[model samples]
Target: MEVRLFRRDETDLLQLSIDTLWAKNHVLSRDKQLLNYMFYDNPVSQEIFGEENYGFLGTWLDGRPIGLMGLMAFDLNVKGMKKFGFAPTNWIVPPEYRHTGAGLLLMREMFKWNPSVVLNLGITSNVARMYTGMGGYHVLPDVPRWIGLLQKRKTAEMLLNGDVKFLRFYQEITAVYNQTTYHVERRFDPERWNACYWATFAKRSIGFARGASFINWRYFQHPSFTYQLFTCMDDKGNYQGLMVLRIESILGGQAKIGRLVEFMANDQDSAICLANKVVEIGNENELLFIDFYCFSSISSWGLESVGFKRVLKSESDKLVVPTRFQPIDLETTHMMAALYVSKDVQKKISLIDDQAWYITKGDADQDRPN
Candidate 1:
């Protein structure tokens, strides 16, 4: 079998081609047209990573497809841990071929191709045992992340009582003061990285403006990730807070998507309103795995009231500022949050961080590897 990357303008993989290898995987149990959609399913996801390539390990016996398999690399950056590893993203093998060792053959080939790649498989059913038998370590049962499902009634209640503001492309959110909020407790802006970096965060280069711009590029328009941007304003048209959210999946027939990146909000009621509104919007588009950050530096109450579950919690340990920028005068502190997918399984799952894999291996290879 051959493993190839799909460049744009190449053949679209989502067609009527049938598959014997994928027929037994959990994903195929729900998707009959997976072979066709697999290629096109994660463009929004791949655009963030390099190509969202596949490990199409299929056996060509007598020139006919007999066995098939696939896997993806989780290429996110973790600062000091450059060679951290790759998640053994997805796998499929027909039940009839389960005892044939075809799975072992495909796995050895994948690892031999990249010795540095450590595998992270979802702890589901007997798959974990299969991976362990192949010399793969089981990453302890990760918390079951949960995203709040905002029903129509909850959304309507928020829209009626909570204030909603619309923001066009390049909107700015300038922090009115330098003080940190209650729940998030973000420290002063980092050296050189201020809030204005995000176009909407600041009009003039001041206080936290540069940091905001950095956030916009680092999250929304970054070359290796797809994210949804949100802004909140008070009834008087004053800038309040902004959030950046990306898609993530934590289960087989479902997705655990939530707000993995963001800054804090200015008020409680408005934040809850916007959170509900975003969940409702996500559902309208068939994305149910919805969640907010772990801390509410911006809007804490809304996420809690809407069934947002805090299954996992982590604190930022390091703050890596931009290159070529001078250090700022204020103290530096960083924070992070994550949410989960609520519903939907009609398409191929996109490994959320696969899109955020942009750290190059050229001269920067010494800094990190995955």
Candidate 2:
């Protein structure tokens, strides 16, 4: 068996890995829509993250390539933001090999290349336990709730009318030019991945200091998905909040499919005002499903009042895969899902279970846990 680094020059192997991740042996068979949304319509992101961030590893069994893994530096986005990187996003792996140690090997290879900041993305408890066995530490846990907002809402006529005051507010977004606070207000240039990713950090992780500017650029500006930024303006014309969106076309035809990339609210009234407009836009666009993530209950209230319902019924988390460095005996893990791994993003790559993650002990990979 052989395990090696991913070379971009190997287009056939890469495409084969990508296609396998997209289907065939995925955790959830219904993830094709999500993949189509991510790879097909969202060209900007596909171009930015596709071939670049992956640290591909191929494992050969019986002298034939049977397994593969793509180690993604999920945090190394824009050029400026590359400084703070993490091993959050994970691709596909064959089911048979997850219990083995190939998952750890793939992750170790990912760390060998990135070796930047800590990875804090969420993961299922089962996978987390395996990760603990592998040497990962507990950072933060988030639980994502599937939220639903009323499709039909009654908005304030004052905003719908867009009186003189509202017009001034709209004009103020571009007028106020304080690169410090208002820097968040700067329109994200599609050509500039740094600006877009940094802008995302400002609104998303206020305290988690460092982020990859280049990584951010690739998140929204790449060729895979289209990004739409909705900036907020106070009645006084001051900049308030920013919302990023990624839409995927679905076959159901209820406005296809729509997603709220990220939404941040500076204050209550400002949040209420901003949310009102977003729902209006969603209604106009005929969006089938609009999902939003809120950090605080206060901010969520505005979205809730506007008819959006909570998703998971609990604190929803942005989950990640099992880390490479989890400590085995410590066993500090989410008891409910100590070894859990989400079937969500796995549809994006194809990796033979054993080969995707290799173990020192060459054991048959027919047995898998979750």
Candidate 3:
């Protein structure tokens, strides 16, 4: 048995393991461009780990690939300092190989990279338990998912058995003054984005680095989905915030929904402007509802002010708004995550407080198409 890092050129081995063990016709196996876009073409990883150490760590038995684990590398912000971080994905060890300790081998190899932080977002309940048993990892059962109903009647019908009474306050919540200046663009302005980041988020927030390079690669270069970028500016035309959005059709095209994949703001006014822009987009396109999943209070307060309700666990089961839409799952869903912050980073930020972290659906592979 051999456990080692897979080079960028070993796509065949990675695809074989994914197709054989993960899913029969998985998109990663069928779409090499998407696969490369995720693990290899990531600008963050290329600059930090270089091409040789591109993300996959695989295990082989008798020279045949048996298991594989993919790591999506990014730069984590720790109170103005930049540090290496990675989110694990595509981790699989077939039933036959689970007993061989191959999964543990892959994990052990990953630790050798000495990442400052490891974010395991969108993990399963079983995987959450595994991380709990490992110790030193903080597991969040549910990341807060906020939803704003654009068309109350239609949204209630789709998710709540036509019970419009349950959403009576929808109008009040979606109300916005819309007094700020904003612009919609296909690409991010690097200079303005970096300036916004340094001025507001860099000195205070803790999360993935949201510079222009990250935004461009994450949204514009995506292989499967199209995202609209909305830049919020002050009356004087200075960049203050940005939002990333994607419209999706669900329920076999019976309904359409809007996804707010990323939200960042320098101040409350900018946040409200971005939130109002999303509402405008949703209404113009006639989407049933728009949802944003995030952890930071700083980034989400504006959203709440403009009518996005934090879907509590108690309300989620009853509302039944599906989170997965590529194939349209009707069941209630909650995104679970695990975070391992090194001692040095722990001193700089609080992992126990959800408000200290700024994470959105776009952070990892959560928003990808099936």
Ordered list by lDDT, greatest first? 3, 2, 1
Which is superior by lDDT, 2 or 3? 3
RMSD of each: 16.5, 14.6, 2.3
lDDT assessment of candidate 1:
0.35
Backbone clash count, each prediction separately: 46, 76, 1
Q: Give TM per candidate.
A: 0.40, 0.52, 0.93
What RMSD value applies to candidate 1? Answer: 16.5
Position 203, candidate 2: lDDT: 33
Per-residue lDDT of candidate 2, residues 1-370 (tens digit): 4666545455455555555653554421334333332332332323434644234466655654445653323332221333333333343457765565555565565556433433433345555555565433432243232243322221112112322321221110101112232323435433333343355434333112222332244344343346666666555444555555555443333223345645555665545655666565565666544555332342465566565655331133321111111121112212121111223223422333321211000011101111
Clashes in predicted model 2: 76
Superposition error at 62 for model 3 (Å) = 0.3
Task: Note the Cα lDDT for every prediction shown.
Answer: 0.35, 0.39, 0.80
What is the Å distance of residue 360 in model 1 from its true position? 22
Give the TM-score ranking, best first.
3, 2, 1
Residue 256 C-alpha lDDT in model 2 = 37
Winner by lDDT between candidate 2 and candidate 1: 2
Error of 1 at 191 (Å): 17
